[model samples]
Each structure stands twice: as C-alpha cells, then as structure tokens.
Target: MERQADWRQEKAQALARARVVVIKVGSAVLTDAQGLSTPVLESLARQMAALRTAPDGHERRLVLVSSGAVAAGRAVLRAHGHSGETSGLSARQAAAAVGQGQLMRAWDEVFRAYDFPTSQVLLTRDDLRARQRFLNARNTFAELMDWGVLPIVNENDTVSVSELKFGDNDCLASLLVNLIGADLYINLTSAPGVYAANPQEVPDAGILECVEDVAGLDLGRMCGGKTSVGTGGMYSKLQAARRAAQLGVPTLILPGREADVLARAFGGEAVGTWVRPEEHAIPRRKFWLAYQSDPAGTVLVD
Candidate 1:
C-alpha cells in the first residue's frame, strides 16, 4: 500500500512538471480498415488542444510522432490494383509516398479547427545518426516550439531503406524524447496499457499500473505480434518505454481509442500504465554512444 501511494504521488508530480511532452500515436489508433480515421484525428486534436494549457495556465509544448502514412497510402492504392497485402519494401515505400500528403492534410485540417499551426517533420534514422545532423534536427524542433507550431513528425519511409529505417514510430518517439529533452513521453496505443501476460492468449491477464523497473520486465512473455495496421506491437512499446526510462523520462502507455484519453490521463486519472524513470539520468554522451552511434568497423580480437 505504501509503494502504491508513493508511485501515485510520483506519477502526479511527473505529469504536473511535464512542460514539453512527446506523444506517439500508433497507426492502429490513427487508422482504420478504410484508411486514416478522420474522426479519431478530430477527437485526438480536441483533447490535445485542451492539454496544451497546463493547470496553472502555462503553455505546454507538444510534439506528435504519428504513424499511418503507409496504411493510408495502401488504402488509397487498393482501388488501383494494390491488393490484400504488400510485402515488398518498395511497395511499402510507395504507399508511404502516396499517403504522406493525405496524412498531413488530415492532421492540418483537424488541428486548424483549434487555430493551431503545424509543421510536418519527416526523418530517417541516418538523419539523426550523425552528430551535426542530430544537432540540426534538435535546433529545428526548438524553433518549431518557439514559433508555437506543433511539429507532426513521421519517418521518411519513402526514401528510407532497410538499413536506415526506424522500423516504427515507437523507436522514433523514444529517440525524439532524448533529442528534444522532453519532460514526458506519452505513447497512445490500442491497448489500455502493458499487461502481465499476452492478453490475447490469457484472457485473465491484468494491466500493470506502474512499472518501477522496466529493464527487469520479461517482455518476451508479455508481448505479442504486430497489429494488422501497424508495424509495432506491445514489444516495441516496451522497448521504447525502456529507452525513455534510461533517459530519465517517465512514459505513459494509454488507450488511444478512448475519447479524451489524453485529457483524462493528464487530469490525474489513472488511465494507463506508467513506467517510472531512473533516479539519475544516464549522461547524454554515454547514451548517444551506446544507442545512437553505429560501429565504424568490426575488429577480430580473437
């Protein structure tokens, strides 16, 4: 009971102190069987607009990492002979190219209703792998926040090859948290939160309210396969949360399908799983060296 109380207090404090937040909405939450879900976009936009103003009336900055361009593009191309499923990398990239514009337009229109301007920021893994490029991207994000324009970020799937692809927005969002120095990381998904076991396989599985040791969790048994509409699954979210924890940023995995979910979660309602961060943040340089940089060459010491 005392541990629960302590975590609840910490959760409230984290939410209250979060001035810059990175929210990553998975494709399952953003898309439907047809394509991009305009209704979901509108609902999320409304909630996000409300969340922009803190309880004390201070302006909060939000950076959205959205995934759905490929799904949207595939939906559109289905009429033009693109069929049941696409497996090739080129096919997926083609779909992203087609749907990128549509995705942006939908977001622009939805957010515009709230009188909020937005900027589309597409990135590739390679873009952030280099030191100068990483700094440049950070500066761009800073300027976007300064101008009060919400930066709608996505992977540059159209040009990204297998070697440089982010795989999913989950990975991208985790990286962005470190790059932007975001106070909080919110991952809105189809599920309510992380479960003790794969909920599909075990109907009795319960949600984990707070995870104090993300690294100690057995993700293999707890996660399942990717969603039909998205590249990531619970495993990816867990990995993302783990990264955020290492960076000393608290992560919330909430149900994106619930209307006003963001508002509810931010309003101190226990709506999802909260992963606590480390007591001391790992140094940025050390983190970058371990996670961001690629090995230049392989050495055969043996």
Candidate 2:
C-alpha cells in the first residue's frame, strides 16, 4: 500500500493559503555518513509540488533554506585523501568549497524534474546584521517570490570564517522568516517531534503536541547539536520556532524523513510540535532585540 498524507486537515488548508512559507532542511535529513541523500531532496520537491497544485488560490510561494554543503564537500575531499580538515578556518571553508556546487547541482536536477526553477542564494550573518545589506537581501527575496522562483539558500561557507557559518540552518531559517515576513516557518528534520522525556533514554518519552509558551518547557534537555554531518538538532528547531512566535509567525517543527511530512505537519496529524504566537505579539524589531541581541556587557537604569 502507498502512503499518503491526509491533506484534509485544517493546518493543511491553512498552509496552502499561506502567502509565503520558508522551509529549512538540515544536513542530517539531506545526508548520510558519506554524504547527500538523493531521495530526501526528491521527496521534499514532491511535497512542495503538491502545494503548488492545491486549488483555492493556494498556489504557494516557498523558499527552501538547506544545509549540507560542508558535508557534501567533505565527502568529495575525502575521496582525494585530503582529510577534509584544517587548523581552524580552513576545514570549514574547504568542505564548503567541495560541497556548495554539489549541493546546488543536485537540487537543481531534482527540482527540475518537477519543473520547479530554483535559484541559489548563499548568505552570511553579516548580510542580516547590517541594515543596508539586510534590506537589500530582503528585497531580493521578495522579488524572487514575486517572480515565482524558489530561492534555495545556505550560508556562504566557502568564504566564512570557521565556526561562523549561519552556524546552523535553524538560525538561518528564523532570520529568513524575519527577513521575508513569512506566514509560516517550517523546519523539516529527521526526528519525530519534541518528546516529553529523551525518548532514547526513556522508553516511553512523551511527545509534546503544542507549545503555547516556550519558557514553560525545559528545552535544554531536548537534544544536542548536529548529531551527524549536520550541525543542528531539535534544540535549534525549537529555538527557531520560539523566535518565530515572538515575531508573530507561527512555526511547525517536524520530521522530514518522508516527502509527505510537509503536508502532515500542516494537516494536523500530530507529526510534530506547533508553537503559536502570543496575544500581544512582539514587534519584529523587539523580537530581534530580545532573542538575537548580543550577550554583551549590560547596565540597568532604574
């Protein structure tokens, strides 16, 4: 029997009508120990294609923020016996050099099968932190969506200093949503959902269905970063959603092991966790201030 997502659910319909959606894919989902996973990307394209076809004027506008360039690049380097590592900055830059093209070409081939045109846009934190570059980048995204092109973004790893590449796609995803003013920010990963207890350790760990307020949850105990070739885990996903909620954008974090997970997430099948914005949603600038502000020296005025 073939598997299918029940798109008849409420969130499924809402997702179809969502004016703009930003989806982030982690390295774990897109790669194996050796490298990039072909089936994963293909499955992702299938889900996006469905939303594109949905009636009700739902013709969705989407942006995919993907991570895996370094993994892919490292794989290529390993084949040449280069060790794919460096003292500090060179290791990451080398991996990115080998992987960015590999990643983009693979995506291009799969996306082309669905006739989905994609554009590669590598970004850096500096792009978002600086007001002028940030505005330009935002305008670029808007223009791309306006023209119906899927913008596949990743950190410009090739040129970035070590340990500073968007760090992980989760943070990149959140910032992307902030930049685009997206209606929804969906993080598609390999894990099921946030569990009440660490499932691997606790045989019957409970799955958290919804998040009304993040502070209420003990997320620190959730999971760690980048289990494999990827550099993100459930922790970043939750943080992304929390930041998105504060900015008045609802977020859904779910497993992307299958193509239908996208539909499943919005369809209300309990595939992942949902975090909603508060009543008095924080303004974008304020949300950034609270969440993205630097942990620097502080002084209080009474």
Candidate 3:
C-alpha cells in the first residue's frame, strides 16, 4: 500500500508539472449516431482551457490529435441515402475527404469560444521519413507552440494510402510526443483505462491502474478487441504508450466522455492507467531510425 501511494503521487506530480502535452481523443468518444458530437467537443474545450492556464502560474502548451473524420463523414453520407459501411479504400477516402472539414470546423468553433486559436496540421508518414522534412515539421511545431496556438493534428487520410499511412492517430500522437519533446501524452478513449481483460467480454475485469514495464506484458492476451468507430484499439494504444515510454514520456489512458476527466487526472485523482517512462531516453537519431524509417532489407540472426 505504501508503494502504491508513492507511485500514485509520482504520477500526479508528473502530470501537474507537464508544461507541454499531447492529447489524442479517439473517434468513439467524439462521435455518435448523429456524427461529431459538438457537446463533447465543447466540454473538452472547457477543460482544456483550464489546463492551458495552470494554477501555479505556469502556462501549458497542448497539441490535439483527433480522429473522427471518416466516422463523421459516414454519418453525414448515411443521412443522404448512402451506406455507412464504406466498401473499399477509395470509399473510405471519400468519406474522410467529406468529413475532415466538418471535424475541423467543430473543433475550431469550440476552441474559438474560449478565445483559443487553432491550426490544422495534416501529415503523412512520408513527410517525416526524410530527415530534412522531419526537422522542418519539428520547427513548425515549435513556432506554433511559441505562438500559443493549439495545433490540431491528424493523418491526411484522404490522400494517405495504406502503404504511407501512420496506421492510426495513436501512432501519430506518439510521434508528436517526440517532435515536441512533450512532457506528457494523454490518450482519451471511450474506456476508463487499461483493463485486465476486455471489459465488454469480462464485465468484472479490473482496470490496471499502472503499467510499470510495458514490454514485459502479454499484450495479446490483454487487448484484442477493437471499436467500430475508431481505427485504433487497446493494443495500438499500448504499442503507442511503449513508444512514448521509450522516448522518456509517460502516457495516460483515460475516459474521454467524463466531464473534467483531464482535470481530475491531472489533479491526482488517478482516474486512468499510467505507463511510466523508461529510466533513460532514446537517442534522437536512434528513435528516428527505429520509428520513421522503413527497412529495405532484414538480416536473419541464428
């Protein structure tokens, strides 16, 4: 019990001291049968406003990685005599194209109400693959943060083919953490936190509050289920958290739909699963080589 208290306090202090944070909100938490939930966006914006102006007189910089374009597009198209189930890659791309505007507008409007300016930043894997391009992207993020602007990032799904895609927003958020050298990575999803089993399957499955060693866990047994509305599942979140951990940034997976969830977690309420960072940070060059580069050949070791 004393050890548990120590860890909880440590996590709370980390969260409180985080000056730069990357927040990724999953599609399941942002959309519903009608499409993008404006109410949810508004609620999140209110909470984020409070976060930006820290109580201790330290300002916070935030980067929002949001996923909901295709889901929102499907909802709009369905109301116009189209099926929500997109047939092929092209069909899904079309949905993303139609919905990306709506998604941005919803975010822009909500943040504007709180006097916060936002910028849309769409990226593909290829953009970061090149060294110069990677540096350029990093510089851009620096400028945005310096200007006190909220950079809303997303995969350019309309143009990103499977071969060039970032896989999901969770992966994109992980990369963003390294790009900005973020202090914390907050992943808000429909579920409260990481669970011992899929909560839907095992109704009484306990939530795992802290993940001390991400690499040692049996992720296959812990997470396999995926939500219909979001491209990422619990497995992807764990993988992303592992990546962030390697970069010396802790990750918090929390319930997105709850009011003031970010506030509560940052205030030491311990409302989610916290993945602690490794003792040492990965070197920048090595992190890029491992994550950004595509291998041309593989050597087999016996």
> Which pairs of residues collide in candidate 1?
none
Candidate 1 residues 1-302, lDDT tens each?
A: 13344888999988888899999998999998889999999999999888888888889999999999998998899867868656578888888999999999999999999988999999999988998899999999999999999999999998999889888999999999988989899999999899989987999999999888999989888898999889999999999999989888999999999979988887889889999987778987677777787889787996
- Stretches off by above 4 angstroms in model 1 are 1-5, 297-302
Clash count, predicted structure 2? 3
* TM-scores for all predictions: 0.95, 0.87, 0.94
Q: Give the Cα error of residue 70 in candidate 3, in Å.
A: 0.4
List where candidate 3 sits over 4 angstroms from the true fold.
Answer: 1-5, 296-302
Compare candidates 1 and 3 on TM-score and give the better one.
1
Predicted candidate 3 versus true structure: per-residue lDDT over 51-160, tens digit per residue: 99776889999999999999989888988998656847898889999899999999999999889999999999998888899999999998998998999999999999
lDDT measured at residue 104 in model 1 versus the true structure, 0 to 100: 94
What's the number of clashes in each of the models? 0, 3, 0
lDDT, model 3, position 79: 86
**Residue pairs clashing, model 3:** none
- Order of models, best lDDT first: 1, 3, 2
